[model samples]
Target: MKKIKYFYNTNTLRYEKLVTPLRVRLLRVFGFVSALLVSSALVIWVYTRFVPRPTDKVMEYRYNSMKENYATLKSEVKTLQDQIAQLEKRDNEVYRSIFEANPVPDSMRVKLIEKKKELDKVEALNDDQLSNEIANSLNNIAARISYQRTSYDGIEKLINNQEAKLSSIPAIQPLSNKDLTRIASGFGMRIHPIYGIPKMHNGLDFTAPQGTPIYATGDGTVTTAGVGNGTGNHVIINHGYGYETVYMHMVRIKVRDGQHVKRGEVIGWVGSTGASTGPHCHYEVHINGSPVDPVYFFYNDLNAEQYDRLLKLAATGSAKSFD
Candidate 1:
Protein backbone atom coordinates (compact mmCIF):
# COMPACT_ATOMS: atom_id res chain seq x y z
CA MET A 1 0.00 0.00 0.00
CA LYS A 2 1.20 3.58 -0.83
CA LYS A 3 1.01 6.12 1.95
CA ILE A 4 0.52 9.84 1.30
CA LYS A 5 1.89 12.61 3.46
CA TYR A 6 -0.15 15.86 4.18
CA PHE A 7 1.25 19.33 4.67
CA TYR A 8 -0.25 22.65 5.84
CA ASN A 9 -0.97 25.18 3.10
CA THR A 10 -0.59 28.45 4.86
CA ASN A 11 -1.96 30.36 1.89
CA THR A 12 -5.34 28.63 2.21
CA LEU A 13 -5.01 27.83 5.99
CA ARG A 14 -6.10 24.24 5.36
CA TYR A 15 -4.52 20.70 5.27
CA GLU A 16 -3.49 19.41 1.82
CA LYS A 17 -1.69 16.26 0.34
CA LEU A 18 2.00 16.98 -0.12
CA VAL A 19 3.69 16.46 -3.56
CA THR A 20 7.58 16.63 -3.15
CA PRO A 21 9.58 18.41 -5.90
CA LEU A 22 11.66 16.27 -8.25
CA ARG A 23 14.76 18.30 -7.46
CA VAL A 24 14.37 17.83 -3.67
CA ARG A 25 13.89 14.04 -4.05
CA LEU A 26 16.95 13.81 -6.25
CA LEU A 27 18.98 15.88 -3.80
CA ARG A 28 18.00 13.63 -0.93
CA VAL A 29 19.06 10.48 -2.84
CA PHE A 30 22.41 12.10 -3.70
CA GLY A 31 23.06 12.97 -0.02
CA PHE A 32 22.44 9.35 1.08
CA VAL A 33 24.81 7.93 -1.60
CA SER A 34 27.52 10.43 -0.70
CA ALA A 35 27.37 9.62 3.02
CA LEU A 36 27.50 5.86 2.36
CA LEU A 37 30.54 6.19 0.09
CA VAL A 38 32.37 8.36 2.69
CA SER A 39 31.67 5.91 5.56
CA SER A 40 32.87 2.90 3.47
CA ALA A 41 36.11 4.71 2.55
CA LEU A 42 36.86 5.60 6.23
CA VAL A 43 36.35 1.94 7.34
CA ILE A 44 38.61 0.63 4.60
CA TRP A 45 41.36 3.12 5.50
CA VAL A 46 41.29 2.06 9.19
CA TYR A 47 41.37 -1.67 8.36
CA THR A 48 44.34 -1.33 6.03
CA ARG A 49 46.21 0.77 8.61
CA PHE A 50 45.77 -1.73 11.50
CA VAL A 51 45.86 -5.14 9.77
CA PRO A 52 48.45 -6.70 7.35
CA ARG A 53 47.64 -8.84 4.31
CA PRO A 54 49.04 -12.38 3.86
CA THR A 55 51.34 -11.31 1.03
CA ASP A 56 52.62 -8.38 3.05
CA LYS A 57 53.49 -10.66 5.98
CA VAL A 58 55.37 -13.03 3.70
CA MET A 59 57.30 -10.14 2.16
CA GLU A 60 58.24 -8.85 5.60
CA TYR A 61 59.51 -12.28 6.66
CA ARG A 62 61.62 -12.60 3.51
CA TYR A 63 63.13 -9.15 3.98
CA ASN A 64 64.05 -9.85 7.59
CA SER A 65 65.57 -13.19 6.61
CA MET A 66 67.61 -11.58 3.88
CA LYS A 67 68.97 -8.97 6.32
CA GLU A 68 70.06 -11.68 8.74
CA ASN A 69 71.72 -13.61 5.97
CA TYR A 70 73.53 -10.50 4.78
CA ALA A 71 74.87 -9.92 8.25
CA THR A 72 76.20 -13.44 8.48
CA LEU A 73 77.74 -13.21 5.05
CA LYS A 74 79.42 -9.94 5.97
CA SER A 75 80.94 -11.46 9.09
CA GLU A 76 82.26 -14.42 7.10
CA VAL A 77 83.79 -12.13 4.52
CA LYS A 78 85.56 -10.14 7.18
CA THR A 79 87.01 -13.31 8.69
CA LEU A 80 88.30 -14.45 5.32
CA GLN A 81 89.89 -11.07 4.72
CA ASP A 82 91.66 -11.19 8.07
CA GLN A 83 92.94 -14.70 7.39
CA ILE A 84 94.25 -13.64 4.04
CA ALA A 85 96.01 -10.70 5.59
CA GLN A 86 97.76 -13.02 8.03
CA LEU A 87 98.79 -15.30 5.20
CA GLU A 88 100.22 -12.36 3.28
CA LYS A 89 102.24 -11.28 6.28
CA ARG A 90 103.65 -14.76 6.75
CA ASP A 91 104.43 -15.10 3.06
CA ASN A 92 106.35 -11.84 3.02
CA GLU A 93 108.25 -12.19 6.27
CA VAL A 94 108.82 -15.93 6.59
CA TYR A 95 108.45 -17.78 3.31
CA ARG A 96 110.27 -15.18 1.22
CA SER A 97 113.28 -15.40 3.51
CA ILE A 98 113.92 -19.02 2.55
CA PHE A 99 114.99 -18.03 -0.97
CA GLU A 100 116.30 -14.56 -0.08
CA ALA A 101 113.62 -12.92 -2.17
CA ASN A 102 112.07 -9.55 -1.68
CA PRO A 103 108.62 -9.49 -0.18
CA VAL A 104 105.58 -9.05 -2.33
CA PRO A 105 104.72 -5.40 -2.10
CA ASP A 106 101.60 -4.12 -0.37
CA SER A 107 100.63 -2.40 -3.59
CA MET A 108 100.14 -5.81 -5.19
CA ARG A 109 97.54 -6.73 -2.57
CA VAL A 110 93.93 -5.62 -2.24
CA LYS A 111 93.28 -2.05 -1.25
CA LEU A 112 91.37 -2.22 1.98
CA ILE A 113 90.09 1.32 1.92
CA GLU A 114 88.63 1.00 -1.54
CA LYS A 115 87.06 -2.35 -0.77
CA LYS A 116 85.59 -1.03 2.47
CA LYS A 117 84.10 1.97 0.73
CA GLU A 118 82.47 -0.29 -1.82
CA LEU A 119 81.15 -2.57 0.88
CA ASP A 120 79.87 0.35 2.95
CA LYS A 121 77.30 1.01 0.29
CA VAL A 122 75.71 -2.37 0.97
CA GLU A 123 73.09 -0.99 3.34
CA ALA A 124 71.61 1.03 0.48
CA LEU A 125 71.94 -1.74 -2.10
CA ASN A 126 69.25 -4.01 -3.35
CA ASP A 127 69.56 -7.75 -3.10
CA ASP A 128 71.18 -8.21 -6.48
CA GLN A 129 73.72 -5.47 -5.96
CA LEU A 130 74.74 -6.84 -2.57
CA SER A 131 75.21 -10.29 -4.04
CA ASN A 132 77.43 -8.97 -6.77
CA GLU A 133 79.53 -7.08 -4.28
CA ILE A 134 80.18 -10.17 -2.18
CA ALA A 135 81.07 -12.16 -5.25
CA ASN A 136 83.60 -9.61 -6.36
CA SER A 137 85.29 -9.59 -2.97
CA LEU A 138 85.58 -13.37 -3.01
CA ASN A 139 87.11 -13.29 -6.48
CA ASN A 140 89.73 -10.78 -5.39
CA ILE A 141 90.73 -12.94 -2.42
CA ALA A 142 90.96 -16.04 -4.60
CA ALA A 143 93.28 -14.29 -7.01
CA ARG A 144 95.63 -13.28 -4.21
CA ILE A 145 95.73 -16.85 -2.93
CA SER A 146 96.67 -18.05 -6.40
CA TYR A 147 99.50 -15.56 -6.62
CA GLN A 148 100.85 -16.59 -3.22
CA ARG A 149 100.87 -20.24 -4.26
CA THR A 150 102.91 -19.39 -7.34
CA SER A 151 105.44 -17.50 -5.26
CA TYR A 152 105.88 -20.53 -3.01
CA ASP A 153 106.59 -22.66 -6.05
CA GLY A 154 109.42 -20.37 -7.10
CA ILE A 155 110.85 -20.43 -3.58
CA GLU A 156 110.84 -24.22 -3.60
CA LYS A 157 112.88 -24.31 -6.79
CA LEU A 158 115.42 -21.88 -5.39
CA ILE A 159 115.81 -23.97 -2.24
CA ASN A 160 116.46 -27.09 -4.30
CA ASN A 161 119.14 -25.37 -6.35
CA GLN A 162 120.70 -23.96 -3.22
CA GLU A 163 120.94 -27.46 -1.79
CA ALA A 164 122.73 -28.65 -4.90
CA LYS A 165 125.17 -25.76 -4.72
CA LEU A 166 125.97 -26.48 -1.09
CA SER A 167 126.59 -30.10 -1.93
CA SER A 168 128.96 -29.29 -4.82
CA ILE A 169 131.35 -27.14 -2.77
CA PRO A 170 134.77 -28.47 -1.79
CA ALA A 171 134.57 -29.24 1.89
CA ILE A 172 137.11 -31.94 2.80
CA GLN A 173 140.82 -32.66 2.90
CA PRO A 174 142.44 -34.30 -0.13
CA LEU A 175 143.88 -37.11 1.94
CA SER A 176 143.29 -38.82 5.27
CA ASN A 177 145.39 -37.16 7.95
CA LYS A 178 143.59 -37.84 11.20
CA ASP A 179 146.80 -37.68 13.27
CA LEU A 180 147.94 -34.49 11.46
CA THR A 181 151.49 -35.67 10.68
CA ARG A 182 151.69 -35.78 6.85
CA ILE A 183 152.10 -32.05 6.08
CA ALA A 184 155.76 -31.92 4.94
CA SER A 185 155.87 -28.34 3.56
CA GLY A 186 153.25 -25.59 3.89
CA PHE A 187 152.15 -22.86 1.54
CA GLY A 188 154.13 -19.58 1.04
CA MET A 189 157.81 -18.95 0.22
CA ARG A 190 160.22 -21.87 0.63
CA ILE A 191 163.76 -22.75 -0.51
CA HIS A 192 163.53 -24.65 -3.79
CA PRO A 193 165.47 -27.92 -3.69
CA ILE A 194 166.35 -28.01 -7.42
CA TYR A 195 166.87 -24.22 -7.93
CA GLY A 196 168.55 -23.51 -4.56
CA ILE A 197 166.52 -20.22 -4.24
CA PRO A 198 163.37 -18.95 -2.48
CA LYS A 199 160.25 -19.78 -4.52
CA MET A 200 156.51 -19.47 -3.90
CA HIS A 201 155.21 -22.88 -2.85
CA ASN A 202 151.61 -22.67 -4.16
CA GLY A 203 150.33 -25.79 -2.39
CA LEU A 204 150.70 -27.92 0.73
CA ASP A 205 153.05 -30.90 0.44
CA PHE A 206 152.05 -34.05 2.35
CA THR A 207 154.86 -36.54 3.10
CA ALA A 208 153.43 -40.00 2.46
CA PRO A 209 154.72 -43.34 1.18
CA GLN A 210 155.03 -43.77 -2.60
CA GLY A 211 151.89 -45.87 -2.81
CA THR A 212 149.76 -43.72 -0.44
CA PRO A 213 146.35 -42.98 -1.94
CA ILE A 214 145.39 -39.38 -2.74
CA TYR A 215 141.65 -38.57 -2.67
CA ALA A 216 139.43 -36.10 -4.46
CA THR A 217 138.52 -33.18 -2.18
CA GLY A 218 135.08 -32.55 -3.64
CA ASP A 219 132.41 -33.74 -6.05
CA GLY A 220 133.44 -32.76 -9.57
CA THR A 221 134.50 -33.89 -13.04
CA VAL A 222 138.20 -34.49 -13.57
CA THR A 223 139.42 -32.03 -16.19
CA THR A 224 143.09 -32.97 -16.11
CA ALA A 225 144.45 -36.48 -15.54
CA GLY A 226 147.92 -36.42 -17.06
CA VAL A 227 151.43 -35.18 -16.41
CA GLY A 228 152.73 -31.62 -16.07
CA ASN A 229 156.35 -30.41 -16.22
CA GLY A 230 156.20 -29.04 -12.66
CA THR A 231 153.17 -30.98 -11.27
CA GLY A 232 154.08 -34.54 -12.46
CA ASN A 233 151.23 -37.06 -12.80
CA HIS A 234 148.56 -34.59 -11.66
CA VAL A 235 144.74 -34.57 -11.52
CA ILE A 236 142.62 -31.42 -11.64
CA ILE A 237 138.94 -31.66 -10.65
CA ASN A 238 136.56 -28.92 -11.69
CA HIS A 239 133.94 -28.47 -9.03
CA GLY A 240 131.38 -25.90 -10.12
CA TYR A 241 130.65 -22.63 -8.35
CA GLY A 242 134.05 -21.12 -9.02
CA TYR A 243 135.97 -23.92 -7.25
CA GLU A 244 138.63 -26.34 -8.45
CA THR A 245 141.11 -28.72 -6.80
CA VAL A 246 144.47 -30.12 -7.92
CA TYR A 247 146.45 -33.16 -6.79
CA MET A 248 150.04 -33.11 -8.02
CA HIS A 249 153.15 -35.33 -7.93
CA MET A 250 151.22 -38.59 -8.19
CA VAL A 251 152.82 -41.95 -9.00
CA ARG A 252 149.73 -43.08 -10.95
CA ILE A 253 146.58 -41.19 -12.05
CA LYS A 254 143.48 -43.27 -11.44
CA VAL A 255 140.89 -40.85 -12.92
CA ARG A 256 140.31 -40.23 -16.65
CA ASP A 257 140.20 -36.84 -18.34
CA GLY A 258 136.42 -36.50 -17.90
CA GLN A 259 135.58 -38.89 -15.12
CA HIS A 260 133.12 -37.72 -12.48
CA VAL A 261 134.37 -38.33 -8.93
CA LYS A 262 133.02 -37.80 -5.44
CA ARG A 263 134.67 -36.54 -2.30
CA GLY A 264 137.12 -38.98 -0.64
CA GLU A 265 137.45 -41.05 -3.86
CA VAL A 266 141.04 -42.02 -4.62
CA ILE A 267 142.23 -40.14 -7.69
CA GLY A 268 145.95 -40.84 -7.58
CA TRP A 269 148.87 -42.18 -5.56
CA VAL A 270 151.63 -40.14 -3.90
CA GLY A 271 155.04 -40.13 -5.58
CA SER A 272 158.23 -38.03 -5.89
CA THR A 273 157.59 -37.06 -9.54
CA GLY A 274 158.67 -34.01 -11.51
CA ALA A 275 160.69 -31.55 -9.36
CA SER A 276 159.66 -33.29 -6.12
CA THR A 277 162.50 -34.30 -3.78
CA GLY A 278 160.63 -37.03 -1.83
CA PRO A 279 157.57 -39.27 -2.03
CA HIS A 280 154.84 -36.69 -1.21
CA CYS A 281 151.53 -35.26 -2.48
CA HIS A 282 150.97 -31.59 -3.31
CA TYR A 283 147.36 -30.47 -2.99
CA GLU A 284 145.91 -27.11 -4.01
CA VAL A 285 142.48 -25.45 -4.10
CA HIS A 286 141.71 -22.85 -6.78
CA ILE A 287 138.87 -20.42 -7.10
CA ASN A 288 138.23 -18.94 -10.52
CA GLY A 289 141.69 -19.97 -11.75
CA SER A 290 143.57 -18.51 -8.76
CA PRO A 291 144.83 -20.73 -5.94
CA VAL A 292 143.51 -20.36 -2.39
CA ASP A 293 144.74 -22.18 0.72
CA PRO A 294 143.43 -25.76 0.71
CA VAL A 295 143.61 -25.91 4.50
CA TYR A 296 140.46 -23.80 4.78
CA PHE A 297 138.33 -26.30 2.84
CA PHE A 298 138.80 -29.11 5.36
CA TYR A 299 136.04 -27.93 7.70
CA ASN A 300 133.78 -30.88 6.97
CA ASP A 301 136.25 -33.35 8.40
CA LEU A 302 138.05 -31.38 11.17
CA ASN A 303 136.78 -30.23 14.52
CA ALA A 304 137.92 -27.10 16.36
CA GLU A 305 140.99 -28.64 18.05
CA GLN A 306 142.07 -30.55 14.98
CA TYR A 307 141.60 -27.51 12.77
CA ASP A 308 143.67 -25.34 15.11
CA ARG A 309 146.47 -27.90 15.17
CA LEU A 310 146.38 -28.25 11.40
CA LEU A 311 146.47 -24.47 11.03
CA LYS A 312 149.57 -24.29 13.23
CA LEU A 313 151.30 -27.02 11.28
CA ALA A 314 150.51 -25.45 7.89
CA ALA A 315 151.69 -22.02 9.08
CA THR A 316 155.01 -23.42 10.39
CA GLY A 317 158.08 -22.24 8.44
CA SER A 318 159.86 -25.03 6.62
CA ALA A 319 163.45 -24.97 5.23
CA LYS A 320 162.70 -26.49 1.82
CA SER A 321 159.78 -27.45 -0.50
CA PHE A 322 159.24 -31.14 -1.30
CA ASP A 323 158.37 -30.25 -4.91
Candidate 2:
Protein backbone atom coordinates (compact mmCIF):
# COMPACT_ATOMS: atom_id res chain seq x y z
CA MET A 1 0.00 0.00 0.00
CA LYS A 2 1.31 3.52 -0.79
CA LYS A 3 0.80 6.37 1.66
CA ILE A 4 0.91 10.05 0.76
CA LYS A 5 1.52 12.97 3.11
CA TYR A 6 0.19 16.54 2.79
CA PHE A 7 2.19 19.64 3.75
CA TYR A 8 0.82 23.11 4.64
CA ASN A 9 1.78 25.49 1.87
CA THR A 10 1.70 29.08 3.00
CA ASN A 11 1.93 30.33 -0.55
CA THR A 12 -1.16 28.40 -1.49
CA LEU A 13 -2.84 29.41 1.83
CA ARG A 14 -4.43 26.06 2.16
CA TYR A 15 -3.55 22.40 2.98
CA GLU A 16 -3.23 20.45 -0.25
CA LYS A 17 -1.82 17.04 -1.28
CA LEU A 18 1.99 17.64 -1.14
CA VAL A 19 4.06 16.86 -4.24
CA THR A 20 7.85 16.40 -3.62
CA PRO A 21 10.21 17.45 -6.44
CA LEU A 22 12.63 14.82 -7.89
CA ARG A 23 15.63 17.10 -7.13
CA VAL A 24 14.76 17.27 -3.42
CA ARG A 25 14.39 13.51 -3.19
CA LEU A 26 17.67 12.99 -4.94
CA LEU A 27 19.43 15.42 -2.52
CA ARG A 28 18.13 13.60 0.54
CA VAL A 29 19.26 10.16 -0.79
CA PHE A 30 22.77 11.53 -1.59
CA GLY A 31 23.24 12.96 1.95
CA PHE A 32 22.23 9.62 3.59
CA VAL A 33 24.68 7.59 1.40
CA SER A 34 27.54 9.99 2.10
CA ALA A 35 27.02 9.68 5.90
CA LEU A 36 27.01 5.86 5.74
CA LEU A 37 30.32 5.79 3.78
CA VAL A 38 32.00 8.17 6.28
CA SER A 39 30.93 6.02 9.26
CA SER A 40 32.26 2.81 7.58
CA ALA A 41 35.61 4.47 6.84
CA LEU A 42 35.99 5.57 10.48
CA VAL A 43 35.36 2.05 11.79
CA ILE A 44 37.89 0.52 9.37
CA TRP A 45 40.52 3.10 10.42
CA VAL A 46 40.08 2.20 14.12
CA TYR A 47 40.41 -1.57 13.50
CA THR A 48 43.56 -1.23 11.43
CA ARG A 49 45.16 1.13 13.95
CA PHE A 50 44.70 -1.16 16.98
CA VAL A 51 45.07 -4.69 15.45
CA PRO A 52 48.04 -6.59 13.95
CA ARG A 53 47.76 -8.35 10.59
CA PRO A 54 48.94 -11.97 9.95
CA THR A 55 51.86 -10.86 7.87
CA ASP A 56 53.01 -8.38 10.53
CA LYS A 57 52.96 -11.10 13.21
CA VAL A 58 55.01 -13.42 11.05
CA MET A 59 57.55 -10.69 10.25
CA GLU A 60 57.95 -9.79 13.92
CA TYR A 61 58.60 -13.43 14.88
CA ARG A 62 61.21 -13.77 12.19
CA TYR A 63 63.00 -10.60 13.27
CA ASN A 64 63.20 -11.76 16.89
CA SER A 65 64.50 -15.14 15.84
CA MET A 66 67.16 -13.55 13.68
CA LYS A 67 68.38 -11.43 16.60
CA GLU A 68 68.72 -14.50 18.82
CA ASN A 69 70.60 -16.40 16.17
CA TYR A 70 72.94 -13.53 15.42
CA ALA A 71 73.79 -13.24 19.10
CA THR A 72 74.64 -16.92 19.27
CA LEU A 73 76.83 -16.59 16.22
CA LYS A 74 78.65 -13.66 17.70
CA SER A 75 79.28 -15.61 20.89
CA GLU A 76 80.72 -18.49 18.93
CA VAL A 77 82.99 -16.17 17.04
CA LYS A 78 84.16 -14.67 20.28
CA THR A 79 84.99 -18.13 21.62
CA LEU A 80 87.02 -18.92 18.57
CA GLN A 81 88.88 -15.64 18.89
CA ASP A 82 89.74 -16.38 22.51
CA GLN A 83 91.07 -19.80 21.63
CA ILE A 84 93.23 -18.32 18.92
CA ALA A 85 94.63 -15.76 21.31
CA GLN A 86 95.64 -18.56 23.68
CA LEU A 87 97.38 -20.38 20.89
CA GLU A 88 99.33 -17.30 19.94
CA LYS A 89 100.40 -16.81 23.52
CA ARG A 90 101.56 -20.37 23.81
CA ASP A 91 103.45 -20.14 20.57
CA ASN A 92 105.36 -17.15 21.82
CA GLU A 93 105.89 -18.32 25.39
CA VAL A 94 106.26 -22.09 25.24
CA TYR A 95 107.18 -23.59 21.88
CA ARG A 96 109.20 -20.65 20.64
CA SER A 97 110.84 -20.32 24.00
CA ILE A 98 111.94 -23.93 24.07
CA PHE A 99 113.29 -23.86 20.54
CA GLU A 100 114.74 -20.39 20.98
CA ALA A 101 113.00 -19.20 17.86
CA ASN A 102 111.28 -15.93 17.23
CA PRO A 103 107.54 -15.62 17.50
CA VAL A 104 105.32 -15.44 14.43
CA PRO A 105 105.00 -11.93 13.16
CA ASP A 106 101.80 -9.94 13.45
CA SER A 107 101.44 -9.92 9.70
CA MET A 108 101.07 -13.69 9.79
CA ARG A 109 98.13 -13.44 12.19
CA VAL A 110 94.56 -12.23 11.54
CA LYS A 111 93.84 -8.52 11.67
CA LEU A 112 91.26 -8.69 14.39
CA ILE A 113 90.90 -5.00 15.03
CA GLU A 114 89.09 -4.20 11.79
CA LYS A 115 86.99 -7.35 11.89
CA LYS A 116 86.07 -6.76 15.51
CA LYS A 117 84.84 -3.27 14.71
CA GLU A 118 82.45 -4.63 12.12
CA LEU A 119 81.26 -7.41 14.40
CA ASP A 120 80.60 -4.95 17.22
CA LYS A 121 77.88 -3.42 15.04
CA VAL A 122 76.22 -6.75 14.29
CA GLU A 123 72.85 -5.36 15.30
CA ALA A 124 73.02 -2.89 12.44
CA LEU A 125 73.86 -5.46 9.80
CA ASN A 126 71.46 -7.10 7.43
CA ASP A 127 71.44 -10.82 6.79
CA ASP A 128 73.68 -10.66 3.76
CA GLN A 129 76.12 -8.28 5.39
CA LEU A 130 76.35 -10.41 8.52
CA SER A 131 76.98 -13.52 6.51
CA ASN A 132 79.79 -11.90 4.57
CA GLU A 133 81.38 -10.56 7.72
CA ILE A 134 81.38 -13.95 9.43
CA ALA A 135 82.80 -15.58 6.34
CA ASN A 136 85.70 -13.18 6.25
CA SER A 137 86.42 -13.79 9.91
CA LEU A 138 86.41 -17.53 9.45
CA ASN A 139 88.77 -17.25 6.51
CA ASN A 140 91.19 -15.23 8.55
CA ILE A 141 91.10 -17.80 11.33
CA ALA A 142 91.79 -20.61 8.91
CA ALA A 143 94.78 -18.79 7.50
CA ARG A 144 96.19 -18.13 10.94
CA ILE A 145 95.80 -21.78 11.86
CA SER A 146 97.74 -22.75 8.76
CA TYR A 147 100.54 -20.39 9.67
CA GLN A 148 100.77 -21.87 13.15
CA ARG A 149 101.05 -25.34 11.69
CA THR A 150 103.91 -24.27 9.50
CA SER A 151 105.66 -22.69 12.44
CA TYR A 152 105.40 -25.94 14.36
CA ASP A 153 106.96 -27.81 11.47
CA GLY A 154 109.93 -25.49 11.50
CA ILE A 155 110.34 -26.02 15.23
CA GLU A 156 110.31 -29.79 14.70
CA LYS A 157 113.18 -29.48 12.25
CA LEU A 158 115.17 -27.42 14.72
CA ILE A 159 114.62 -30.08 17.35
CA ASN A 160 116.04 -32.64 15.01
CA ASN A 161 119.18 -30.59 14.31
CA GLN A 162 119.69 -29.98 18.02
CA GLU A 163 120.86 -33.60 18.46
CA ALA A 164 123.65 -33.16 15.94
CA LYS A 165 124.73 -29.93 17.58
CA LEU A 166 125.01 -31.68 20.95
CA SER A 167 127.20 -34.44 19.57
CA SER A 168 129.47 -31.98 17.79
CA ILE A 169 130.54 -30.31 21.04
CA PRO A 170 133.94 -31.23 22.47
CA ALA A 171 133.02 -32.91 25.72
CA ILE A 172 135.57 -35.64 26.55
CA GLN A 173 139.17 -36.44 27.32
CA PRO A 174 141.73 -36.97 24.55
CA LEU A 175 142.94 -40.18 26.20
CA SER A 176 141.96 -42.70 28.90
CA ASN A 177 142.50 -41.28 32.38
CA LYS A 178 140.47 -43.64 34.58
CA ASP A 179 143.28 -43.81 37.15
CA LEU A 180 143.15 -39.95 37.46
CA THR A 181 146.96 -39.78 37.49
CA ARG A 182 147.81 -39.03 33.84
CA ILE A 183 148.00 -35.21 33.66
CA ALA A 184 151.76 -34.44 33.42
CA SER A 185 151.45 -30.71 32.83
CA GLY A 186 148.41 -28.38 33.06
CA PHE A 187 147.65 -25.32 30.97
CA GLY A 188 149.35 -22.07 32.07
CA MET A 189 152.77 -20.47 32.07
CA ARG A 190 155.32 -23.25 32.61
CA ILE A 191 159.11 -23.84 32.18
CA HIS A 192 159.80 -25.22 28.72
CA PRO A 193 161.93 -28.39 28.91
CA ILE A 194 164.12 -27.50 25.93
CA TYR A 195 164.11 -23.71 26.15
CA GLY A 196 164.49 -23.79 29.97
CA ILE A 197 162.58 -20.50 29.95
CA PRO A 198 159.05 -19.63 31.01
CA LYS A 199 156.59 -20.16 28.10
CA MET A 200 152.80 -20.23 27.70
CA HIS A 201 151.59 -23.84 27.89
CA ASN A 202 148.29 -23.67 25.98
CA GLY A 203 147.45 -27.40 26.26
CA LEU A 204 147.42 -30.17 28.86
CA ASP A 205 150.13 -32.84 28.71
CA PHE A 206 149.24 -36.45 29.65
CA THR A 207 152.40 -38.51 30.36
CA ALA A 208 152.10 -42.03 28.95
CA PRO A 209 154.41 -44.70 27.52
CA GLN A 210 155.26 -44.55 23.85
CA GLY A 211 152.69 -46.13 21.50
CA THR A 212 149.79 -45.49 23.92
CA PRO A 213 146.65 -44.84 21.85
CA ILE A 214 145.33 -41.26 21.75
CA TYR A 215 141.63 -40.70 21.19
CA ALA A 216 139.69 -37.95 19.44
CA THR A 217 137.75 -35.84 21.94
CA GLY A 218 134.72 -35.10 19.73
CA ASP A 219 132.98 -35.89 16.44
CA GLY A 220 134.55 -33.86 13.67
CA THR A 221 136.54 -33.87 10.47
CA VAL A 222 140.31 -33.81 10.77
CA THR A 223 141.63 -30.58 9.32
CA THR A 224 145.37 -31.26 9.87
CA ALA A 225 147.00 -34.61 10.54
CA GLY A 226 150.68 -33.89 9.91
CA VAL A 227 153.76 -32.43 11.57
CA GLY A 228 153.54 -29.04 13.28
CA ASN A 229 156.69 -26.97 14.17
CA GLY A 230 156.51 -27.48 17.97
CA THR A 231 153.49 -29.84 18.02
CA GLY A 232 155.20 -32.88 16.47
CA ASN A 233 152.79 -35.21 14.58
CA HIS A 234 149.47 -33.59 15.64
CA VAL A 235 145.84 -33.90 14.55
CA ILE A 236 143.40 -30.97 14.48
CA ILE A 237 139.75 -32.00 14.57
CA ASN A 238 137.35 -29.26 13.45
CA HIS A 239 134.24 -29.82 15.50
CA GLY A 240 131.53 -27.45 14.38
CA TYR A 241 130.04 -24.63 16.47
CA GLY A 242 133.29 -22.72 16.94
CA TYR A 243 135.13 -25.66 18.53
CA GLU A 244 138.37 -27.49 17.66
CA THR A 245 140.58 -30.08 19.38
CA VAL A 246 144.32 -30.72 18.89
CA TYR A 247 146.39 -33.81 19.78
CA MET A 248 150.11 -33.33 19.53
CA HIS A 249 153.39 -35.26 20.15
CA MET A 250 152.08 -38.46 18.53
CA VAL A 251 154.37 -41.42 18.00
CA ARG A 252 152.00 -42.76 15.32
CA ILE A 253 149.49 -40.76 13.26
CA LYS A 254 146.54 -43.16 12.69
CA VAL A 255 144.08 -40.70 11.07
CA ARG A 256 144.81 -38.71 7.92
CA ASP A 257 143.63 -35.32 6.81
CA GLY A 258 139.93 -34.89 5.83
CA GLN A 259 138.85 -38.00 7.73
CA HIS A 260 135.66 -37.78 9.81
CA VAL A 261 135.93 -39.37 13.23
CA LYS A 262 133.74 -39.87 16.31
CA ARG A 263 134.50 -39.14 19.95
CA GLY A 264 136.88 -41.66 21.65
CA GLU A 265 138.14 -42.94 18.28
CA VAL A 266 141.89 -43.61 18.15
CA ILE A 267 143.55 -40.93 16.04
CA GLY A 268 147.22 -41.23 17.11
CA TRP A 269 149.67 -42.63 19.69
CA VAL A 270 151.59 -40.92 22.51
CA GLY A 271 155.26 -39.92 21.92
CA SER A 272 157.80 -37.17 22.52
CA THR A 273 158.53 -36.03 18.99
CA GLY A 274 159.27 -32.31 18.56
CA ALA A 275 160.34 -29.85 21.23
CA SER A 276 159.48 -32.44 23.88
CA THR A 277 161.40 -34.03 26.75
CA GLY A 278 159.34 -37.20 27.50
CA PRO A 279 156.66 -39.49 26.04
CA HIS A 280 153.36 -37.60 26.46
CA CYS A 281 150.16 -36.55 24.65
CA HIS A 282 149.50 -32.80 24.31
CA TYR A 283 145.77 -32.07 24.11
CA GLU A 284 144.24 -28.63 23.42
CA VAL A 285 140.74 -27.23 22.95
CA HIS A 286 140.29 -24.09 20.87
CA ILE A 287 137.12 -22.02 20.68
CA ASN A 288 137.09 -19.60 17.76
CA GLY A 289 140.88 -19.92 17.53
CA SER A 290 141.36 -19.08 21.22
CA PRO A 291 142.89 -21.79 23.38
CA VAL A 292 140.95 -22.81 26.52
CA ASP A 293 141.83 -25.20 29.36
CA PRO A 294 141.62 -28.80 28.19
CA VAL A 295 140.84 -29.95 31.70
CA TYR A 296 137.32 -28.49 31.42
CA PHE A 297 136.39 -30.74 28.46
CA PHE A 298 136.75 -34.04 30.34
CA TYR A 299 133.36 -33.93 32.09
CA ASN A 300 131.85 -36.69 29.92
CA ASP A 301 134.43 -39.32 30.95
CA LEU A 302 135.08 -38.53 34.65
CA ASN A 303 132.91 -38.88 37.80
CA ALA A 304 132.59 -36.38 40.67
CA GLU A 305 135.49 -37.46 42.90
CA GLN A 306 137.66 -38.40 39.98
CA TYR A 307 137.01 -35.07 38.27
CA ASP A 308 137.71 -33.18 41.48
CA ARG A 309 140.98 -35.04 41.94
CA LEU A 310 141.88 -34.51 38.30
CA LEU A 311 141.14 -30.83 38.60
CA LYS A 312 143.47 -30.60 41.60
CA LEU A 313 146.19 -32.51 39.78
CA ALA A 314 145.96 -30.33 36.72
CA ALA A 315 146.03 -27.17 38.79
CA THR A 316 149.11 -28.31 40.75
CA GLY A 317 150.73 -30.26 37.91
CA SER A 318 154.46 -30.29 36.92
CA ALA A 319 155.72 -26.78 36.34
CA LYS A 320 157.72 -27.92 33.28
CA SER A 321 155.78 -28.52 30.00
CA PHE A 322 156.47 -31.61 27.84
CA ASP A 323 156.20 -29.60 24.55
| Each candidate's clash count | 0, 0
lDDT of 2 by residue, 202-287 (tens): 99999889999999888899999999778899899999889999898898899998999998899999998877889999989999
List candidate 1 segments past 4 Å from native: 1-143
Instruction: List per-prediction Cα lDDT, in the order shown.
Output: 0.85, 0.86
Model 1 Cα RMSD, Å?
Answer: 8.0
Best by lDDT: 2
Q: Over 4 Å off in model 2, which ranges?
A: 1-126
What is candidate 2's TM-score against the reference? Answer: 0.63
In candidate 1 the C-alpha lDDT for residue 185 amounts to: 83
lDDT of 2 at 203: 92
